[model samples]
Target chain A: MSLSKQHELHTRRYGRNVGVGLLLVGVIAIVFGLTVVKVTRGDYETPATTTVQE
Target chain B: MTDTSFNSQTGTYQTEATFGDYFALLKPRVMTLVVFTAFVGLLAAPTPVHPFIGFCAILFIAIGGGASGALNMWWDADIDAVMKRTQRRPIPAGKVTGDEAFAIGMALSAFSVVFLGLATNWFAAGLLAFTIFFYVVVYTMWLKRWTPQNIVIGGAAGAFPPMIGWAVATGGVSVESVLMFCLTFMWTPPHFWALALFMRKDYDNADVPMLTVTHGRRATRVHILVYTILLAILAVAAGFTSIGGPIYLSVAVVLNVLFLRGAWQIWRRDEDMSEADNFLTERKFFKLSLLYLFAHFGAILVEAGLDKLGWGLWA
Candidate 1:
């Protein structure tokens, strides 16, 4: 293959791979975000600072 | 071992690994567990750490965990390359250089330990340093390649985060902290051996002396059953401590029953039968196993919350 053709091929491959990776990441983030929302349900308080004392 | 695509061609398709590739070398999933357990340790302590300082301490410890993972990847790239599960790792897949991985790991190690010591206390820093050493030297370098008992002894690295967290808060270890350590430690063998039972080929190909390879699958099954019994005892004991309450006890009771039943079923399996048929059961246990640790520590936090409101059982 010609130099320009090889370069084009590499660019196309890289773009495709990056697109797939980003899609996977996006899906994961969405699922994770929804799960956190469901679990916390806006009832999230900062962790308490005091230890239990008798 | 240059490939034909690179060396044979005048115009080669040579690619260099990027910065993100190096970061990917760290086992982030494992790091999450370290962070959660450490947070529990910090929260459960008798003494309270300043919120800002505690956050920073746990952050440094997590970075320390990532550093250990990077170093492990660097060292184990050879074996990792051969194993199907680890073949896509940055170093083995030609996405990161071994030297680059080593440098990142070492730099992070120094930064994490020193800053942790300054931010929290020397005891926490010392524990972090030893954890990195144990994982790198004892587990990755020495035990993993040499023995079937690798995960058992090496499990200590994963178990130490809670102790370190406790030290960060209390400046010393306590029964509660040790129980947390024991819980993770005992849980490791069974968790990993299940993976080994399924992924036997990976260990065999790598020539790693995993229990499945060194001992037969039957032996591994029996060991899992035995360890599950021991782990159950340790886990249930934690429910009776100051950290435990009705919520924790309830969770523990349900978790143990399910876990013990899973083990019992596994022990009952004949070597001739395909694990594939009952793989769902084992996979369910694995999923629950993750929740098991998280829920236990989460319950500890709940107990702490209750104590603050004067409703804690221990109180």
Candidate 2:
């Protein structure tokens, strides 16, 4: 194979791999961010009242 | 300069740079040790880190370690090209340029530190930054050529990962974490000196001023024996800490005995012995040193697991 052709092949493969890796990282980051936000915000709580039982 | 080569047969220019070459610049073997030790530190900490946070911490720590490796390779390209053991490294072998390695290293160093701070805390990030600076600037650029004690001080850079790991968990340092760091720091001299005994010619040809090259084989052996004795004491004493228990104690005791025996053998060798015979013992000791480290850290991990299961000796 010609040198330029080999270089082109390698560049393409590297680009593809990097693209996939970045995509995965992006998804994980979004999920992690959301989880952090959710945990920090928490949820609404109701006041507790005492009850009498027979 | 671009990493390009003229292919006369193909009558064209091809880029010599590859993913593997870039990855090789990271020194994956060293990164593995950094990652493993850092993980053990996180697990052994009294505080429990969120699983995702721990994953991010380790990832960034590994990146920081890789950054230091790249930067070290960048600065040491000249000496690396001369040393037989390091001649095939990316920059030295013409697979990557020193400039490229430096750029990658700086970029990763920034990325890892910033993201780690955001993911965990500033303390761990700061420690990571210091580790990188110590390795690249202090060790590679300054101490390596100047002193025979290069490994002794430079080993601190490799030692900081566990402390960073512990900081990631507790957002601070402790005696336990420092002990873990000490384990690796103390192990470095004997380990590298053993290799130096067998490969003295490499350092001599490279003019790197390694202990074996500067102090002679006999002195290097004595130094190894002394450091090994100190390391054994520290390793056994570490077993009684919060991070350690019966399992870790057992592992530490057995490993230290064997390690001491190996060091003793190296120390007892006659100056008149055949070079080949001396090389064999040095090589054996060097190989055992690798196992000695991994087993110690692995034992720490087991102790952490046992503590979680409520089977810890102290618990």
Candidate 3:
């Protein structure tokens, strides 16, 4: 293969790896953002006890 | 190694870096400890973290730990080149450049910290950032070459992960988290010292001021005993904390006894003993030290699990 072609192929491969890594990061970030929202809004808080009267 | 190719067009040397090389820069083994301890800390916290949040926290903390390892490798490349144990590391072995390692470390450090802050809380992120700084700056750059007490003081960096995990769950620190941190912190000196005892020549050749190199093997042995005694006290005492219970206490007691016996064996050795024999005792102690921390943390994890089941001792 020509030097330019090899260089181009390398560049494309590198870009692909970075793209995948960034995609994973994006997904994790979204999950984290949702969790943060849920936490800050007290979604995980314990429910108040309701006593039953006979 | 750097695979250089003749660029018939530009005629410049270009380094061919690989995925494994980059991964090696992260020091995955150390990252494992950081991740596991942090996971335990998060689970053992009073408030439960959302599953997704917990996973994100551990992932980011591991990244932070890896970043620190890369930065450490970057700075310690010189000593690493001299030492037998680290001579084949990416940088020293000519696989990765110092600049490349530094850039990766800095980028990952910033990425992990920022994303962790967004994922969990700024408190945990801050602790992660401090951990990176302490490992890279305090331990690698400043202390490792300058003082025999490097591991003693610098162990705090390794000790912070569990606390950060706890912070991820509660957005604050507590006595439980502090005790967990103490467990790792106190365990650090003797662990490294035992390894140093066996690998004394590595520090000597590198001219790093490890206690073994600075104070002689006898003094190092004395230090090990002293630290192990102190560690035994701390490790067992940690069992009584809120994070600890019958399971943790039982594990801690047995592990500390074995650990103390190992330290005593090392302490009792005299100069007349063969290097091979000394190496055996030190190597055994070193191996046990690894299990000592893991079992302690594992026991804490079991206690946390039992707590969730309403079967914990305190429950």
Tell me, per candidate, how large a share of the native contacts it keeps: 0.00, 0.00, 0.00
Which residue ranges in model 3 land beyond 4 Å of their true spot? A1-54, B5-15, B271-274
Clashes of each: 0, 0, 0
Q: Could you give the DockQ of candidate 2?
A: 0.12
Question: Clashing residue pairs in candidate 3, if any?
Answer: none
How would you class the docking of model 3?
incorrect
Error of 2 at B286 (Å): 1.0
Write one digit per residue (lDDT tens) for candidate 1, span B270-290: 655545575665666677788
DockQ of 1: 0.03
Order candidates by lDDT, high to low. 3, 2, 1
Chain A TM-scores, one per candidate?
0.53, 0.57, 0.61
Tens digit of per-residue lDDT, candidate 1, span A1-54: 655545555553575467568856954664465446435654356677998899
What docking grade applies to model 2?
incorrect
| Candidate 3 chain B: 10-residue stretch with minimal lDDT | B6-15
Model 1 C-alpha lDDT versus the unseen true structure = 0.82
Candidate 2 residue spans exceeding 4 A from truth: A1-54, B1-15, B271-274
Tell me the spans in candidate 1 whose CA falls farther than 4 Å from its real position. A1-54, B1-14, B275-278
Candidate 3 lDDT, B7-87, residue by residue in tens: 332233444656777888999988889999999999988898878778878999999999999999999988888899997
